[model samples]
Target: MTSPRINSVSIMHYTRPYIELARLEKPTGSLLIFWPFEAWGLTMAAFRTHLPLKYYIPNLLRYLAAAIIIRSCGCTVNDIVDRNIDGNVSRTKKRPLPSGRISVRSALLFLVVQYLVGIVFFVAFLEGLALRTALWQLIPM
Candidate 1:
């Protein structure tokens, strides 16, 4: 019992850096990305079409998940790209990459993993043009 508890705590400690790297602590970014594009659009469409609760609720959940993943990916890319500049900045100096809590190589791997998950999610839950459009959104303009 003691050993398992210690291990779980250790795992959480190890993941802290990655979580910060992905900006999971601050969810405003995710919500900002979600509401304007996904949430409102879906809500209006469901209202107009009289879509059933079963479909609307599940789709909303999926969009929420996508928003989180997409925001995480964007933050990781920003941190990786601005690592050097961030180290010299006052506000961003303590970020994971700048603070040396996470290596660039590790961050890149994490970013790739995020993109893969996003792709798999869109492909699995969406179809045809919807799938293509969702996948296209994953690529930065």
Candidate 2:
């Protein structure tokens, strides 16, 4: 059996690059995008009559989660598209994609997984709230 130090080192080696890949290490960009949209959505949602804190609070938390997922997705896509460009820039050269920490294909796969997980979370939250759109409204005439 592997020792604990070796196990932890292997885990960090495998997983640490993804933190930079997802932009979690620098969250100001995500927060900038998350807070304003969240504020606007919460404000609009609050305008509805009789929205108790019990209802609003859970939804608020879900929205926050969604914002973080979306921001991560945006960061991933940007990294994918700008990998070559980022390599040329001093500030971004050490990013996961540009720095050879992760392969392009692996980064793309990670992005797809992130999107699927985000979709699952969204569907679960909506299902929990019984939110739905009628089939008729979705059909084009």
Candidate 3:
């Protein structure tokens, strides 16, 4: 049978569950992954130069947004890649992908869009740098 049409209400209803599946609802998981990046980036920037604190606020926001998007995309890709296993596993059987709350194509498209957005924020780091240096980080993407 063809897949049923997914509507706004359906999406809203599953939003909380989806966040759990993506681990956004879990603070420890996010902290464990993002703390190192934040510490290193801030320490490196501070160690590299002695500037005013306000100067780094914007950069901090850009990096935070980038990290959240990148992590969310990774979770989305994982769910898509492991749909079969998740469906069979007791732990993830109720997840968005396995429970028919999300589609595979939707997951891939979300990842692509999130990654593109993440790259755009990455360019903020290369703001004062040459174009050549920025190109290297993008080749893998």
lDDT of 1 by residue, 64-140 (tens): 99999888888998999999999999999999899998899999999999899999998889899988887777776
- Write the residue-wise lDDT of candidate 2 on 18-60 in tens digits: 8888888788876786578775768677877667888888877
Among all candidates shown, the one with the greatest TM-score: 1
Worst 10 residues of 3 by lDDT: 130-139
Winner of 2 and 3 under lDDT: 2
Regarding TM-score, does 1 or 2 come out ahead? 1
Q: Quote the positional error of residue 20 for candidate 3 in Å.
A: 4.9
Which tens-of-lDDT digit does each residue in 1-141 have in candidate 3?
999999998886867655755567755645655568764667687768975668766666655655565566667767878899999999889888798866777666666766676567666565555334433433333
Looking at model 3, the pairs that clash are none
Cα-based RMSD of the predictions, in order? 2.2, 5.6, 6.1
- lDDT of predicted model 1: 0.91
- Least well predicted 10-residue stretch by lDDT in candidate 2: 131-140
Write down the TM-score for model 3: 0.68
